[model samples]
Target: MTMVSNEYGKIITIEQAVEMIDDGCSLMVGGFGGIGSPPSLLQAIIDKGVQQITLICNDTAFPHIGVGPLVAQGRIKKAVVSHIGSNPIAGQLLHEGKMEVEFSPQGILIERIRAGGAGLGGILVDIGVGHEWLAKGKPTVDIDGNRYLLERPLTADISLVYAKKADPFGNLIYDKSARNTNPLVAMAGRITIAEVEEIVPLGELDPEEIVTPGIFVTYIVQSNGVDWKWIWE
Candidate 1:
């Protein structure tokens, strides 16, 4: 389907955005730790009380921040992520066998998202080949007499992304450091829902700055403050 620019950019509250996601969905959340998190949206989702989510992200943050509330509420069933060191709740859940965790290297995670966005089956990376994780009994296959590990595609039913600015065309631009995982996550979903701090007219955004194109985006919502646990604030 072709994504067209709308004259009137539909602006909805954070509550409206969270209601669109249902239970038992594969969700790709854009952020690293708590940096690029869509806090208000996360809170709304926690309020909605949806369960059995398969969350895909770079890292899982702490109990009170980022995806923490969902984990604290026992909403997430599984998570495929790169890092989990910061979130002790996640660790406790993993130990208790309450939540399933699939760990991936950071680079491979990005490649998996890219593959999904491009409609590819999977990605083959040497990073996992002969690694302790794979050697310890994970599946491996030989391709053309070369041993390679398969990193499955990370397609999501819904993608929750935070951006600095979004044009009515659905094109997105994210600020520095905040852009982590956002662009890739946006493409890897069937329905890409973006939360932007600012919404601008179509063509207002520079072509060079457009990280996510309009075709991949399905919805746009405006957001207020982000949720970050400071070590700073």
Candidate 2:
């Protein structure tokens, strides 16, 4: 593959991008199941044998989809996710005491990530007030005669994201529902790597269509496309 570069010099190969992620690092992945996930990047990580990862994402996806293969292969030490029902391996690992799982409400999970990107300490919400599982060990705040749980902001050492199109500068556009959590996750990482199906020249993308600005992306890798057959099986 020819090296794509711009004045910002953010474009890089998948191997070079994955090298930035060390063992035991916190990783925030953007996707709703397999839709928006960066398959080539995730597969590269698996091949690199990076271990003890703390994965933060919306769901575990299916065993052969998205981040689920990482979870199934025991690559993750802990997972902070909204749901793991789609991937039985995650449940099995949790039950077998091989992995740690933190459950977060879908809305709150993205909000917490948003807060991290915005550089806020945390956010207060009442969604899990009376639920023991959600409220356990959490600090409560009282205001206007009501109590709310203080959900701490979440940030990651590295974030992996998939985009439908991106410029060399990393301005990104997602395909429909695949955009879920990617914009938020893009901002919350110290180093954000975006795998894109197409990399257009700078200024070719309309400003209004770019969901994630180039400033939030540290690197951009060309994608090798995902095989959707995994989903049907």
Candidate 3:
């Protein structure tokens, strides 16, 4: 693994952090209505002008928040999300054929990531048995002479998650309601990148509080705070 550590392990810059992200890759972003987005890192990507991304997120919040800015900028070519009802830009993109939208059920979306992280080839779920938009593959496997629909693995090139604190070794601690889909997404990606408000020394955190271990994390970026309004309150 290509792990970079500074003298104090705190010199990781936004540019250095997001440099690993490449265009035309499948990405999963962790945040609910932009509440936990890594603002500095996301802005860096916007500033860098990367394009042709397939984003997997919970909800495409209104323009300028969550995945909305990326979608509005035309950087994201496709999105697999739970809900796109909150963003007008998303609807416009879909209507204009500027973006491809795949709306998965909220619950199955979580399982898809979790299954990928666990090294499973895929998961069998009953969320979208007859849906058209999100359902494309018809995989049948017989279990005890019964048939079941298969939900394939959703592996991402990169997963961007926001956390309250992370140790230099990459252990993560998400604050309160900030833990959305981040925990599972952290492991589902080939390269998991985390943006946190604080990055501390290793062994400084209680083992019980570590939601994600260093093995699953590839990079750590320091985030001042998310740019969107908190909705979980």
C-alpha RMSD between model 2 and the true structure: 1.6
Q: What TM-score does structure 3 among the candidates reach?
A: 0.88
**TM-score per model over all chains:** 0.89, 0.96, 0.88
**Per-residue C-alpha lDDT of model 3 across residues 135-222, encoded as one tens digit per residue:** 5665766678665668776779989888998888788999887888889889989888888888776677899999988788887887
lDDT tens digits by residue: candidate 2, 1-233: 44445778898899999899889999999998789999999999999999999999999998888998999999999999999999999999999999999999899899999999999989999988998987998999999999999999999999999999999889999999999999999999999999999998887899999999999999999899988975665
lDDT of 1 by residue, 1-233 (tens): 33435565545667777877889988899988877877777878888888999999888787778787787777889999987888888988889999999888899888999999999988877676766855454457788988877777889999888899998878899999999989999999988888888888777899998988988888888787763446567
Question: How should the candidates be ordered by TM-score, best one leading?
Answer: 2, 1, 3
Model 2 spans with C-alpha error above 4 angstroms: 1-4
What stretches of model 1 exceed 4 Å from their correct place?
Answer: 1-11, 131-145, 227-233
Return whichever of 1 and 3 wins on TM-score: 1
Look at candidate 1 and give me any clashing residue pairs.
Answer: none
Q: Candidate 3: lDDT over CA atoms?
A: 0.80
